[model samples]
Target chain A: MMIISTSYHIFVKEFVSEFRTRYALNALLMFVVTTLSIILFSIGQESPSIDVLSGTLWIVIFFSAMSGLSRTFVAEEERGTSLTLRLLVNASSVYIGKLVYNFALILVLSVIIAVSYVLFITEFTVKTFEIFWLTILLGSAGLASASTILAAIIAKANTKGTLFPVLAFPILLPLLLTCINATKLATEGAFLVEAVKEFQILISFTVVMIATSFLVFDFVWKD
Target chain B: MKTWLKIAVSVWLTGIIIAGIAFPMVKVPQTWYEFPFIPGLEEKARNIIFHVPISWATVVAFAMSMIYGIIYLRKKDIDYDLRSVSSASLGLLLCILATVTGAIWAKFNWGSFWNWDPRQTSIFILLLIYGAYFVLRSAIDEEERRATLSSVYSIIAGVTVPFFIFVMPRIMSGLHPGSLGDEQGKGPVLEFKMAPNMLMVFFASLIGFTVLYFWMYSLKVRQMRIERHVQQITETH
Candidate 1:
C-alpha cells in the first residue's frame, strides 16, 4: 500500500540520517564490546554455559540500545531544527520512521553482540546461535517500538533529555522478560513448540505497543 | 459549597469508618486461614482484604484519567486537561497504595517483600512508570504545553503500565502469582471468603477511593478555572 511504501522510504531516510550522526553507532559498539569484555572477565576463563551468557547478551544489547535511544530526539533539539522536521511530516510518520530505523540499528548491533558473546563468554553452537539471532529480531523490534514512541512524547519537553528511557524501560520490561526466556529456552535446545507462549507474549507486546502509540501519538506530540 | 456533595462525602466516610470498625470484630465465614499458613503466610488471607481492591480501584481511576486525557487533547479544553491531571495524580496515589499493600502481601505469601517475580515486579514497574509521568509533568512550566504533553504521555504511559504489570513477569522467570496466565493460580480466589463485614470493608475502600478521585479532580478543575479568571480580569484593567 501507499502507506507502507511511504513509511519504508521515510524509514530509509531516517536510518541514513542517524547513521551519519556521529557517536551513536560508535558508542553503541563500544558499549557492547565493553560489556562483553566485562562479563568475560567476570566469568573468567571458566567455561560458563551458553545458557548463562545468553541473557547477558540480551541485557547488554538492550542497555546499549537504550543508551542510544535515550538520545534519539534530543540531539535535534540542541541543533534547534527539530521543530522544522515535525512541521514537515505527520507526527505518526516520524514515529514510524524512527522505529524502523532504530529497529535496523538494534538488529545489527544485536548480531555483533551475539558474535562477541560467543567469542568472549561461551561457545554458542550453531543451533543456539541461530535462535539467539531470532530472539534479537523479535526483541529489537520491541525495543525500537517502545523507545521510538516515548521519544516522540518527550521530544519537545523540558526533560526531553531524561524522559526517553525513564518512560520506556518500565514499558519494555515484559519484552525484556520474553527475550530472556526465549533465549534461555533456545539455548537449552527446548523446542520452539515449548516456548510458544513466551514467543506469543513478545509478539503481542510488540503489536499492542505499536497500535497504542499510533492512536494516541498525534494528540500528544508537542511542538 | 455544594450541600449534596458534602453530605455524600460525609455519608461515605461514615460508612467507611463503620466498616473499618466492624470487619475485624466479625469472624470470617469459614476461615481459609483455619488451615496451617506457611512460614510467612498466616496473613495471606488478609491480603485479599487490601491488595486486590486497591489495585482494582487504582486501575479504574487510571483508566478514567485516560479518558479525560483523550477528551482534553481532542478539545484543548483547559478544564478537561486539569481534570485529566488530577485524575492521573489520584491514580498515581492509588498506584502507590496498591504497590505498598501488594508488597506487604508478597512478604506474607512469598516470604520476601520483594521478589523479581512477574506480578510483584511488574506492579512495581507500573508504579515507576507513573512516577516518571509525574516527574514529566512537574518538569514543564507552560500550562497548555504541560497539560497537552502530559495528557498525551498519560495515555501512552497508561498502555505501558498494564503491559509491564500483567505481562512481563509471567513471561520471564519471576516467582510471583498470576504469571502463568492459567485459571488454576496459586492463591485462593481473592474475592471469596468474606466475613460480610470484611466485604463491607472492601466495598467501603472502593467507594472512599472513588469519591476521593472525584473530589480531587473537581478541586483541580476549580483551581485552574480561578487562575484563568484572575488572568482575564487583570488583562481587562
Candidate 2:
C-alpha cells in the first residue's frame, strides 16, 4: 500500500522533472507533427480515411513512446539522485514511479495523436466511444510496460541511446501485435467481443511485463 | 597441435570409420532403402543431417554462452566474459547456418524461401535482436563497462531466445518444420536409414560439435586474456 501510493506520487514528481529537464514531450510533439505531415504529404492529396488515420496515430504514439523511453529513468542517474531514490523508496516503487510516469506520457501522446488524427485525416469520427477509449486504454498501458522496462535496462548501460531500441523492440513485439489488432477492430467499428482475445492478450501482456519489471528492476537498480 | 590432439583425432577418426562402415551395414531397417520416407522427404533427409545438427549445436552454444555470462556476473571475471562472447559467436554462426539451411529446405518444401509467416518472422527477429547485442557492445568503450553491459545483454537476449524459439511459435500457427516438438528429426525423417546407425551418427555429431564449441571458446578466452595483458603492459610503459 505504502509502496503503491508513494510511488504514484513520486511518479508524478518525476514526470514533472522529465517535463522540465528532458523537454522530452516538446521534442516528441515536434516529431509527431513531422511524422503526420510526412504521412499526409506522402499520402498525396488522397485523404487517408479513418483507417489510415488510426495507423498513423498509433505509429506516432509508438515512436514518441520509444524516444521518450530512452530518457525515462535516466534523470535520477543524471542528477546522481539514484542514491536518494534508493535510500527513500523501495526499488519496486521506483520502477512503479517510472512506469506510471511513462504510462501517463504515452496516454497523453495517444490522445494528442487521436485528436490530430480526427482533425487532419478525414470526416470519419469514432462511432462508439467505448471502442475508441478501450483501444487507447489497453494500448497505452501495454506501451508503458515495454517502454519503462526497456528504459530501466538502457539507463544502466554505457550507451543508453543505442542499446535501448535494440532491447525494447524484441520485448515489445507481442504487445505491438495485440495493440495493432485491437486498433484494427476499433477502426472497423467492431464490438469489443470481436477483439476480445487480442484485448485479453494486451491486458495479460501489460500485467506480465509490469510484474516482471517489478521483479527485475530490483536487480537493475541495485547493480 | 598434432602431438597434443593425437588422442582426440584418433577417437574422432575411429568413430567416423565405425559410423561410415560397420553401423549402417548392420543395424538399419531394411525397409528404409526399400521404401520412401513420408512421400518426397527422401532427398530432404540429407538436409536433416546438416540442419538438425547445426541447430542443436547452436542451441548448445547459446546455453554455453549464457552459463559463462552468469559466471562472469558472479565472479566479475573478464576471462569468463571472453568465453561468453566467444560462445555467443559460435552460437550466432550456427544460428545463421540453421536459418540458411532452413530457408533452403523451405524453398524445397514450401515453394518459397521466405514467407512472412509468424515462425519465419519471429526467427528473423531473434536473429536481429542478437546481432544488435553485438552492435551495442561495440558502440561503447571501457572493457569493464562493456563486459558488464554485454554480459547483461547476453543474459537478457539469451532468455528471449527460447521465448521465441519454443513459446512464440506454439502461441501462433505456422508451417515451420520440427515445430510439432515430438516429430523433430526422428523416426521416418529424411535420413531414411536413421534406424540405429543414423541415430548413432546424429548423437555422435551432436557430441562432436559440442567439443568443437568448447575448444573454440577456450582459445578465444586465452586470446582475450593475452590482449588484456598486452594493453596493460603498454599502458604502464
| Candidate number of the best TM-score | 1
Which pairs, if any, clash in model 2?
A: B45-B190
The residue ranges of model 2 lying beyond 4 angstroms of the native Cα positions read A19-22, A45-58, A83-90, A123-132, A156-159, A188-191, B1-36, B158-172, B180-200
Q: After superposition, how far is residue B27 of candidate 1 from its true place, in Å?
A: 7.0
Model 1 error, position A180 (Å): 1.0
List, residue by residue over B4-91, the lDDT tens digit for candidate 1: 8768877876766554433333122355222222223333545554566667767777788789888887888888876776767777
lDDT of 1 by residue, A41-71 (tens): 7886577676566667777987888788867
Q: Please tell me which predicted candidate would have the highest lDDT against the true structure.
A: 1
Best by DockQ: 1
Error of 2 at A100 (Å): 1.1
**lDDT of all the models against the reference?**
0.70, 0.69
Task: Write out fnat for all predictions, comma-separated.
Answer: 0.65, 0.13
Span of ten consecutive residues with least summed lDDT in model 1 chain A: A121-130
Name the lDDT value of residue A144 in candidate 1: 83
